[model samples]
Target: MFDLAEIIDIPPFSLDRQKKGELFTRALSDLTQYHQQNCHEYNQILQLLGGSKNSFSSIEDIPFIPVRLFKEYELLSVDQAEVIKTMTSSGTTGQSVSKIFLDKYTSTNQTKVLTKLVSSFTGKKRLPMLVIDTKAVLKDRNLFSARGAGILGFSMLGYDVTYALDERMELDWEQINAFIQKHKNEQILLFGFTFMIWEHFYKPLQSKGLQLPFENSILIHGGGWKKLIDEAVDNETYKKRIFEVTGIERIFNYYGMVEQTGSIFMECESGYLHSSIFSDVIIRDYKDFRSLGFGEQGLIQLVSLLPQSYPGHSILTEDIGELLGEDNCSCGRLGKYFKVHGRIKNAEIRGCSDTYAEGKK
Candidate 1:
């Protein structure tokens, strides 16, 4: 079994493109055997792809498990006894989905992954992070949530700057003001989903004649911007508005999903989200699986080397992005980095109902 900590840590795996390719080759071989031993669905997928234990030589050559596989089966490459935590996607009413079967190794490793990504972007071992909810995570003992755990894990590491605001949601004015006011002399790091931060925090601050401490501050937001597409906030417009409010010259956005536990793509000062050596982002042509080149946007496919608890080492996702090559980013980081255009919301499939599925695929 691969020890999750050895390969990934706070700085995030930083091999050059050549070494990264080698790492993926090894992961491809190991994950193929692990999947055959534990997951049945991918076994069928492997057979279809003409893949075997020896067939995979590179990460790009490996077969990709669809993101929808979480809705189909347990899909873990580990024993049931080792299972620890299952993170879920927030489904609408009557529909909730979960990615099951995480062992202690997987859980702790997830914390490390998130920690590394967050720290790298902010350059703060403990940033005064402002979260949307302050108490919901600490109070909810009955429900074990992966998303919540992921956020709380990062927040706990830093200064506990999170607080409550509304009845169901938390927006602590004092804490927010205090963090901003104190951090005015330093770089501030703000974390949340894109829509949530824009709607709840940034928009309200604008109305109240407030702005973030610019310059050293960096905003890290995840989840798809599908909701904001119809709301008419283009990336430039959104960034400009945020700049006006926060006065922060640097803004960073990330692209990631729960399935690939190892790495995250972070936007640098150059304004391109760069992939770590531990993962590969494929800009697919439409829904077709074959890889697409730069300047073209299509379905985003992720080939990750970071799944020990499950067979998500290589998975395809519904997001879209364009590839910025090794020479593109002004920041010195290597490997592929792409900007997300938006999520494919119209890709929702109907009539196919599953208990684990929170929404239409």
Candidate 2:
């Protein structure tokens, strides 16, 4: 079995070059061997690609399965009865969702890792959380969707959580007003997907001159710029408009996917998506899958040492990104930092923060 403790025990973004490479490569090799021993499909793929624990030399040389393979296969290293939770990816109409089955150890450790990552940015205090989505998302305990999973996972950061939207996808201004009026003097955390916070909450209120008590709060958002791109709302414009309403300047956007749910890559104050100690990112060429240097755009391949129950540790994602630099970011955090350009051209439009997630939450 994969060693969950070894991977999760590392402090956030503190690994030097030698230690980071050593730990990451060792954990990747362990995950590959564990999955190959238990998952037949994964073993076949590794054998087909001539990959083995004895063959890996560096973190970059680790074998990566296409992320789409999850949608086509049940790639679990554990028994069906051992699955404690199943997380499904957001799928557009007619697209098949990827099912990620998690066992107890994997599930517990994943959420623990997520808490560590989030708390590292938002501090150890459990601030009151303001969720932009409706409360109906948590209605289902089984068959967890991406939006619901994200909400529940992030909810660990706070208590007395307030949902700002009603079930009909309309603003619950009365509740929001009451929530802010209650927590007006306290330091809080505002959590939401990117487009949801804008379309469902920010735009409606901004048009009416409505402002919340966010002067002392922090905004943590994830997902990408495609929807806002279509609406002509880029990051700076979105941040400026949000500041106009809330006076919030400590906004941090994260880059993550449902497959690698726990190892979220967050944008630091210096404006780069950083891989925490448990994860790493690599940019590869579209033509022959060669690794690219800094400032070159290519397919984004994400590696997470936290996937113990599923064969998702090393995944070649469909998103495009550029490796900015390693340990050179002004924020002073270690590991690789990069930029996600968004889904590859002609790729499927997915993720909850992208399109409000049709039929997802």
Candidate 3:
């Protein structure tokens, strides 16, 4: 078993490309064998790809299951009795959702790695948080949708947590203003899915011509950019409009999924999503699934050290992205950083915010 504690102790972005690659290759290779031995379906898939030989010299040598497999099959490396929580991907009325099983070990380490990755940007202290979505999302505890899991996951980084919208997806001005007034002098944190922040929080405030009194606050949002792209909104415009309305200069958009929840690639001041020591992103050719060099856009394959309860260690996602560079970001981070273009065209609209928008239609 590859103990995650060894890498968790290191600073999230401290490992350079060479060092991180060596560690990841070892850890993920071990996880491959671990899953093959414990998960029958995973073993069968590997056997079909080739023989069930798990030894691999490089990260690219490891085979990855399509991310959508979780939607079609129950792929568990651990026994059903060991699952502590099941996380489902966000989907509309008839769309199938991915189900991720988590045991105590996987669950605990997910939080631990997430804390380290987020703290690299937010610092050690937990700030007062105002979530842009309604509190109703967190109602179901055991089976969590990606939206709810996202809310609950990021909520751990803040204190005096508050939701900015009501159950009807209406902006609660009174409550939001009160929260701002109470924490007016402190540095606060705001989180939400990308579209929800735009539709529920930003658009409402913009229409009302209401500016918040958040002198020092950071807004962290993710889920997907499909809805925003439909509106022709780019990252720069999103940040500019948000700054105009809220005066929040520090806004970060992270890239992650329910399958690889904890190992998020957070955006830096340089506007690139960075991979931490515990996780990595590889761009693969759309047709052949071969690894692409930096600056080439293709399907995104995500690998993380946090998924032990299930065979989700390395997954080929439907999203497309291009690797910018490694160990040379202007932000001083020492890992691979890249930009997410969006989901593959004609792919199912399944992001948390995107599904919410579809349901409304």
Candidate 4:
């Protein structure tokens, strides 16, 4: 069995996704076995569920943490000193959420995955990445939130271009225009959350009748349209608006959280978010944990192989998604491509469905 401590301290220097997945599977199985032996909470859950190492033959067998647990528990398997940074969710002012911690190696591995995944998708070695907000917001030490963790983790990828750091996250028109002018011919990558880019940046830019001077510019945003749903935008309208404002063909949406460090499912050209190497996407029926097949929409349960500081072997996300199954992506990546339809309103909220089914594939 591989040592959990060694996995964290050493760099997993593999570029091949399948090989990386093998390493992660083995390492995490060791960690889970270790936790089942050491951590009280983990041990209890395993005992109750009749857990065994054989259960994790595939990613779908991994147990997922309810997103609400972070809000209720300390939720760290490592020592306090080992935590290099803490990130919180940007849900609202008083209702803050926290993701425990990140060690240097964990953070570095996460960045490496981001760079490789994004680079492969955009087909550009490095697009001039424009920061839509402040660097401090990216890696705050204050509270816990998955959104904070995501943005902060992204900032580590040394991107070019001036960052907009207004407290309100409002973009300065002149600065944006000047930056566009400086790299007029370069294909730029604009990154931000769904609401922030839509309400603050896109709308304002479109209203000004201003467009960037690049042909291959792409904008990548995460989170759901729930924030814009209140405004009655809907999915089709939202995508159209993004295309209109960005003036780019490659507008991508990503599905991920702070809990699972490196694995993120990114929206490809075919309008589906493709799963990364470090994780597997399983669509469990809304009420039951039984696995659903392709074209079926249900509660999205992610089995992540990216986490190290915690027991993130499996996490049942509040997001609702549809699995498209394994197929040839036009982008050339193999594996199942899934689309996130939307997220359950709150992390703890459940749908009104019968929990009669319980089967695994």
Candidate 5:
């Protein structure tokens, strides 16, 4: 059986390649059979794919379904009455959105794992938080989009949380200035979507000839890199410009999707996204879905131990990435470290930042 508590109790990046493989192969194999027995639709899909319920020798031997399946079908292993929340993927006006149902057990575990992973970077102390978006995004308590979920997940790490923008999505100078003055001598935390921080926060602050003294603080942003890419902005340029505007030298960008909300791949100081002990990433050949070795760019497949209410334990994402190495990063973190190269060529532009940009226009 897969003991989530055992995995959660372990340090996020403490396991090396061999240890992580052994742990994940057992847990994921058990989870596969559990889902097969509980979810009829999932079982049918596995039966069609000829997936056996027996133990998997390696992590790569486990069958994975396309991530898009969530958008098309309601895949859940728990009963509907047990669901406490429903998380939706970010999308533009008429696009389909994925609905992920979460029961109490899955919801609580997600929060716990997220806290552990994020605290590995930002210490366990909760700091004053400055969110780059408006509070309006979190108005809906029952149904949360990826943007809202991200904010809520990170909000638990901060105290005296304040929004940097108003309900209209405009920069709230008064609110921001107050937050800065109150926490001037302390190291604070800032959170936001990548494009929102760039478009709504950085650009506006720069154009107005304003600068903030946030050198003592850290900023964590992710998602919507696709929109920034369209504007010809790369990661280095984004980091440089953000530092120029906010003076926050410590900025970490994470990579995650709504399907696996808690188990995020956080970028290390060496600028590589790392897989933690609770989750792992595998690059696959775009043509044959064969697992690719390190340094080869291909589709990204993600596996996590966080989803029990749903069969999202293993999913083949549409994003492109390359496995840089295992247990050998300069940052000294164990497990796999890799880099995401954006979405597949023809994949839809459906990140949180891109959706917000389109809706505003």
Candidate 6:
């Protein structure tokens, strides 16, 4: 029995598409049946959708549940006693949030895969960390909203970590200036949710006419682009504005949901999001669910080998995106690259971001 979960921690993190394809096919096929056999609800959906009940050869053959199902049901393959934590997605304006149960193995694997992904982008050595969100987000140990989970997950990559926002969710200028002065002229790592980085950190500093000289910093931000789009801030504008305000230019925007945390797609300088080895992305036509060719925008179906405790390994998300190409990026990274075009219209608006991006208090 090939345990599909093994690949997430397997060695040789080098870029290899041939190896990735074989591993991805088998792992996804095995995980599909694993969830089907253990999670009755998932199996029922598979049968309902006419999905393969056995190993799959094509990634398109994998059946996926709509991400919203997590909020409506507790779908777990592991026994109750095995659950070590329950993570919740960030709540939208009025919609219910997803509650994902995580066992020790699943949680540990998620962290490990995330570590690999981050290390690939921001070198192996840990750097001085500056988080753009307030310190209060980490209070909940059991239930992690998206922002809370993000802070905790990335906090593992750095030492002497400092929060950039204060209790009021406002920029902590005194603390930030002090921290910058303390770590001046050193490589630094920064993490934050997208909206908060713009609204809370970038805007305040820009308005007050202050600059940090973080030319040696690398920032990783994701989540809640809906809010950014609301403000007419495209990725280019966002990056340009940030560069004007601060000297930092090494910024990478990633795309992920609480449903599939470990299998994130991060941006490279080529301006496309690259799929990691542990996961693959497919764009499906809205009506027939068939795979669309490159540059064709459609719904994003994400497949991962990371979720063993919950039936979240493969999910049909509400986001619209297009797979750009494979192994041909200017940044010199391997694997398929893609672009997200925000969420599908009329999908329930829910994310772990503040409403402030829409000009609301």
TM-score of each: 0.85, 0.96, 0.98, 0.82, 0.98, 0.95
Worst 10 residues of 6 by lDDT: 352-361
TM-score of 1: 0.85
Residue-wise C-alpha lDDT for candidate 4, range 65-168, written one tens digit per residue: 56666666666666678778676444443454545566665666677677666666665356677766555554435553565555555554436646654665
Q: What is the C-alpha lDDT of each candidate?
A: 0.65, 0.87, 0.91, 0.63, 0.92, 0.83
lDDT tens digits, residue span 1-361, model 3: 7999887789899988788889988899899999999999999999899865657888988889999999999989999999999999998988899999999999999999888889889999999999999998887899999999999999999999999999899988788879978887899999999998999989988998988877588999997677788899999999999998899999999989999989999999999999999899899999898999999999999999999999999999988899999999999999999998878888888788888888888
Q: Which 10-residue span in candidate 1 carries the lowest summed lDDT?
A: 349-358
lDDT (tens digit, per residue) of candidate 5 on 1-361: 7878887888899998888899999999999999999899899999999866679899998999999999999999999999999999998878899999999999999999999999999998999999999999898899999999999999999999999999988999899989989998899899999999998999998998888989889999988787788899998999999999888888999999999999999999999999999899989999999999988999999999989999999999999999999999999999899998888877877678878877778
Lowest-sum lDDT 10-residue window in model 2 = 352-361
Ranking by lDDT: 5, 3, 2, 6, 1, 4
Could you tell me how far off, in angstroms, the CA of residue 223 lies in candidate 5 after the best superposition?
Answer: 0.5
Model 2: pairs clashing at backbone N, Cα or C within 3 Å = none
Clashing pairs in 1: 164-171, 165-170, 165-171, 212-246, 214-247
Across residues 8-69, which tens digit of lDDT does each residue of candidate 6 receive?
55532345678777777777888888888898888888888875657777777778889999
After superposing candidate 1, which stretches have Cα over 4 Å from the reference? Answer: 1-6, 9-13, 48-51, 94-96, 137-147, 178-186, 212-215, 349-361
Q: Give the Å shift of residue 348 in candidate 2.
A: 0.5
Per model, state how many residue pairs clash: 5, 0, 0, 12, 0, 0
lDDT of 2 by residue, 1-361 (tens): 3476765666789997789888777778878888899999999998899767654678889999999999999899999999989999888778888999999888888899899999999998899999989989787787888889999999988998999899987899798889988887898898988988888889888889987768888999886568788888877898889988888899999989999998999889988899988889989999999889999999999999778789999999999999989987899898899988878878877788764644443
Candidate 4 matches the true fold with a TM-score of 0.82
Candidate 4 Cα RMSD after full superposition onto the native fold (Å): 6.9
